[model samples]
Target: MTAPLLEVNDLKMHFPIKSGLFSRAKTFNRAVDGVSLSIQPGETVGLVGESGCGKSTLGRCIARLYQPTEGRVYFKGNDLVHLSHKALLPYRQNIQMIFQDPMESLNARHTVGEILEEPFIIHGIGDAQSRRRSVAKLLDTVGLPSRSATRYPFEFSGGQRQRIGIARAIALNPELIICDEPVSALDVSIQSQILNLLMDLQQEYNLAYLFIAHDLAVVKHISDRVLIMYLGQIVESAASETIYQSPLHPYTQSLISAIPIPDPHRKTNRILLQGDVPSPIAPPSGCRFHTRCPVAEPRCSETAPSLLEAETQHDARCLLINSQ
Candidate 1:
């Protein structure tokens, strides 16, 4: 079997909060408690969770944008956690990120041409004239007009700006792209277009993607494998079809039930979770999800459950599933 292109083991990202008069007393916000997963070459893994579940934080940690507080991030068997900024340059070329808001991610001062050429310039890929030619080619590749190379980002629509962002991400021919809710800020129609563009790009480049989003339907449409996260931890993981058809964890069931059906005539029951998500700064003991789980028993509050294999290639973290 082919080895994974990227592997993350027990990664954590915690931000410290200080409140004393001297600001000496500190509490850590456990944004990413412990997440472990892998992505094969050219595969797309979907990470689905509600808002404030640390999905974006986890993605940033893997991309080395935010140095993780603990654990290991291995890319091609190289541990990235300990690499300094100067030492990480070579690896940065192979991993790129697409932010959710295109305008914010793009520089207002730079024209499209300059933005696209920046990567080549940083890596010393080509001369001035050659970089310009490459920039024009990138514009065409993303379906933007050559004239767009001279235009500012504010001149284009939201979808067009996103296309430029995608162009920049692919400029270095990255093997892995961390897509942080790339389509969440666009119109519904535009969302499909961007998603299709991303899929096409992946096929053309054999790129692997860690697709992070809150929309279950969007995840189902694009993912080969799906991971359900709650309170900064993965609750269930399996093939996309298996996750949609037969989810094992109560948290996954509630999330799956929330996906809207396209057919108006078809009716489905919704599994409504109780209580709000607890603060990550002080997450509940035992199962982090037990507070909102409808079927949670007393045992759930007393003992945490490890992620256990429920079937071939399927894993879930729940005491009920563990008992079976």
Candidate 2:
């Protein structure tokens, strides 16, 4: 069996929230309580969940953009959580991240060429002449004209800017790319273009992607495996087709049911979740999803369910599923 290209075990990211000015009383927002997943070389794993479900935080932790509060992030068997700046530099080239909003991520002061060239500069991969040539080639690879290298991010459309972001991410020939909702801001038509471009790049470079998004439809189209995340934890995980066809966790079922069908005449059963997502600073006891889970039992409020394998290559964190 091929070894995993990236592995995250019991990852957590907590931010302190201080209320009193001088009291020194602080509480931590448990953004990502405990997440454990792995990605093989040349694979795409889609992480689907509602906004503020800690999906982005988890991605940043894996990319080492945000130092995790707890747990191990192993890339090619080396833990990244505790690596020093100099020691982590080499691994930075192997793992990269594409933010949700290209406009915000790209530097406004720099031209597109400069933005794309920054990666090679930081990694000491090439000289000025070679980097310039590489930058132009990257623009062409992402379906942009070579001339785009001279332009600023604001001068281009949203899709074009995203293309630039993609170009920057691939500049280092990374083994794993954490795509944080890369298409949620683009139009439907443009979103397809970007998604297809990513797929093509994956095949060309054998790249592995941790694709994060709220759209199940988008996830279904690009992902081989899908993980369903709730408040601050993953409730279920399985192959894209298997989870969509038969979601085990109630949260997964609700999310899957909400995907819009193109056929207007076909009847759809939408599971409307009651109540807003609870505060992550103080999430509900036991099953973090029980507050909004449709079929939650009384015991769900007391016993925190463990992520257990319910079948081959399928896992869920639901007491009901475990009881059966």
Candidate 2's C-alpha runs over 4 A off are: 21-25
> How many clashes (backbone N, Cα, C below 3 Å) per candidate?
0, 0
- The sequence of per-residue lDDT tens digits that candidate 2 reaches over residues 210-244 is 99999999998999999999887998999999998
In the range 1-324, model 1's lDDT, one tens digit per residue, is 599999999999998888866776479999998999999999999999988899999999998999999999999999999999989999999999999999999999999989999999999998999999998888888889999998999999999999999999999999999999999999999999999999999899999999999999998899999999988899999999999999999999998887788999988799988879999999989999999999999999999999889988999999999898
Error of 2 at 68 (Å): 0.6
Worst 10 residues of 2 by lDDT: 17-26
Please, what is the whole-model Cα lDDT of each candidate in the order they appear?
0.93, 0.93
Window of ten residues with lowest summed lDDT in model 1 = 17-26
Count steric clashes of candidate 2: 0
Pull out the clashing pairs in model 1: none
**Model 1 spans > 4 angstroms off:** 20-22
lDDT of 2 at 313: 96
* Residue 53 of model 2, lDDT score: 92
